[model samples]
Target: MSQPGPGSNHAPPAARTSPESGPPFSEAGGIPVDAATPVTTFSPVVLEVPGRPVDLRMKVSAPATGDNLPVILFSHGHGPSNFVSSLHGYGPVVDFWAAHGFVVIQPTHLDAMMLGLREADDPDAPAYARSRVEDMRHVLDHLDQVEAAVPGLAGRLDRSRIAAVGHSMGGHTVGVLAGQSTADPADGSDLDLSDDRVKAAVLLAAPGHGEDLAPAVAEHYPALKATAFHGMTTPALVVVGDKDWNAHFSQRRDWHCDAYSRSPGPKSLLTLFGAEHGLGGISSYDAKETTDENPERVAALRALVWAYLRSALYPGDRAWADATAALAAMATPVGAVESK
Candidate 1:
């Protein structure tokens, strides 16, 4: 059903200098660089979300040959780039995930600049904060239709094993899906938006509680003022860049670590050494908004995320552990990985 989106409810640490430590994949974590399978992507797989501002349109990317593929519900961030915040963006992340495994689904949220739907006085302006989550729920609810729209993509999906991955504002959406709740800024009502269908998640450069938000930011997105992590009990891997600081959001660089530091057990943290908000142009191949442009950093980040999702969806997989070791073995590690 329809609900609040981003700007709806709200929401790292580190260890690496560089990940040039070793080869791409060791015995433990990563996959072979050249081993990625071919992928097929279907766009504009439109679906109906009742009460939504517009019809839900998505881009589905999956392996050309695979069975029992796990699913990833990728949510884009509210970046400054016009198209990077929509389904067409995050090519670096989406292509990589779809190449290795997992069926990637990216939705064009109502606030996406690509949609050009926002207005000066629009109630959903500033980003549909709450409605973003609604979009994910709607996507999961209509997987049958989504599969049918994509040729040879049915039955290959493992509906029971689903994970959520989000960056920036999108990470806030994952937080809510993983059980984060907060008090409404307008009223004292509790906002519980977590979804049981999401078994694991990744929160990248996400914000902390609204109470500690920059005075200017909190004024507009008040629902995040007290977004608590005690309720984020889902298994997740939280990724944060050491140098990802934005004065418009918060003055504290460590504010991004709350998703890992404040949350319960079964959570891990990845700290990328010299990265910024874009995390090496994950939004686009050459995203203008990417302050730190390093292809190696992007490769490492994508590999680690893939490994995390692999082991998370499969109980006996060694992808996460192996990838962690491979990263740590780098002569110049990308960052550090730790779990509680």
Candidate 2:
């Protein structure tokens, strides 16, 4: 697919911040450290969203294995859980990425953080989705501050190569963060896209919460309805399974494939063979256990994720893609392999 170049949609990088000027992941909710530690200390922060203090958990990556590693700002799936989903809930995806050489930060958009006193008063009020996206920006800004605090951290993070990856509601959040505007999930209204810090995004099983996929009636998020993500122009990749109930996995796959086709930049889609809504099959901590059950399947899926991450983090590297493609195709019947 045609992935978007550095300067595709939105304003030029000059309009954004430059390395000499400031830090890239700063404002966003990430911390930067110089020492060699696997996990940075956790700091509780309160971000102001329309005069409201939103609680957030922030952390930075340990020392990188290579020089000038790319940064990935991850948004966890919106379940009752916090950023835990990105860390321990799902497979060791985040850990794998970190081990490979990428700074990963996950923001937990707890409803309590934004609901405030009105949470009980407005029983019918829709949960704030926009706030979640903005929170991501806050995390980035915080990372920028970390750079200011610690030297040699400024240029290490390449904001231009930054990417946003999310699952479920988090996927939708990344969509909005990357410029995919849709109607509000609660009311049929347009959503605001004020903060466009994310340059590229990867949507995994993104829910069409407010979509009217059913011809008769359309669901919408009043605060976010009537909004359409235009000129996203950033390179994106959308992955989905075949058994996910939310988007019927297959439907989601088709939707993402179409989205990639419409995107201004290069894009690709990978449908896990018989995968389900919950990556229960592949998202596991025990690589050995999963591999034991189906080594071929696990290997293929790992190659897929590793290849994509490699390309996304280090653009212009086609070797990873080539190797992964060969690995994936090596297995029999294209989409018949088990995820686990």
Candidate 3:
């Protein structure tokens, strides 16, 4: 089952739904919404991949009524595309930056790649890895076209200021885009360094950190390999929940301490104190259990993430002063114990 390429006939999803547009995750039960901005969404145009029929999902947003602005591309973790865009659809983050003044695009890669078609008949087969990267490339190209059509989007997108954000498998895509390898095992052989379009990356709860990918992943794509995040030239901010299954692994440790230390530009690691692997934003976490145990910890986790995103995206912007202050203002919850 081949997918529609970069300029196919698929229609983009309707924009401006709710504040929680990225992934559906609640910290302490109830419902979660963005505390930062008004949810004004923009429509996306469906395009086909050049040489293939894949349909890539992309939404563009600039300041509601401003000129050009920095562009950020958001890629969701691996799984169904719906899983990524359900509630906190990355749209909220895009909307946040747009509200503060920036153009953002979040692409639906996994959905377009796999389309729920199992290739090897094995439920766990790695059917969409190849298609995933291709879709990423296609999305970038599509965005270029989009910028061209909308004159206002042209110069506004600071090519050198572009950044990529990812979680789980999407983080691996960012690593690949950053020139980190996914083939040579000990070396970064599978890296796609040709683009040079991305300026920075934010990898959240990356599943691509282990020595070898998980068994299900390994079985699906035996050629899959990855190396240390050593050669990244641009600044980066790696965020991980301390309780992530691999939080204590050597790869995770090296990525933070060594990778950040050796990188040419500035870099930092932020470990969310009590958040689980999926963080507090995805559905997989047991929010009921967490809330029953501790509530302040949950709020702290969200605040830390929002602050990191603010400072990283806008660097020296004065408006982010509040976010920076919030970062420092964070304190340990009354009864929660901090862990390394």
**lDDT values of the candidates?**
0.80, 0.48, 0.48
How high is each candidate's TM-score?
0.89, 0.65, 0.66
lDDT by residue for model 1 (75-124), tens: 99876667878899999888988988889999998878867665435544
Of 1 and 2, which scores higher on TM-score? 1
**Top candidate, metric lDDT:** 1
Alpha-carbon error at 112 in model 1, in Å? 0.1
Candidate 3, which segments miss by more than 4 Å at Cα? 1-40, 80-88, 110-114, 118-127, 142-144, 148-156, 184-189, 208-216, 221-224, 246-265, 282-325, 333-340
Q: What TM-score quantifies how close candidate 2 is to the native fold?
A: 0.65
Q: Each model's number of backbone clashes?
A: 31, 40, 25
Which residue ranges in model 2 land beyond 4 Å of their true spot?
A: 1-50, 63-67, 80-91, 112-127, 147-155, 183-189, 192-197, 213-231, 246-258, 261-265, 281-303, 333-340
Q: Which lDDT value does model 3 have at 245?
A: 43
Model 1 poorest ten-residue lDDT run: 2-11
Global local distance difference test of model 3:
0.48
Residue 154 in model 1: lDDT: 86
lDDT of 1 at 118: 53
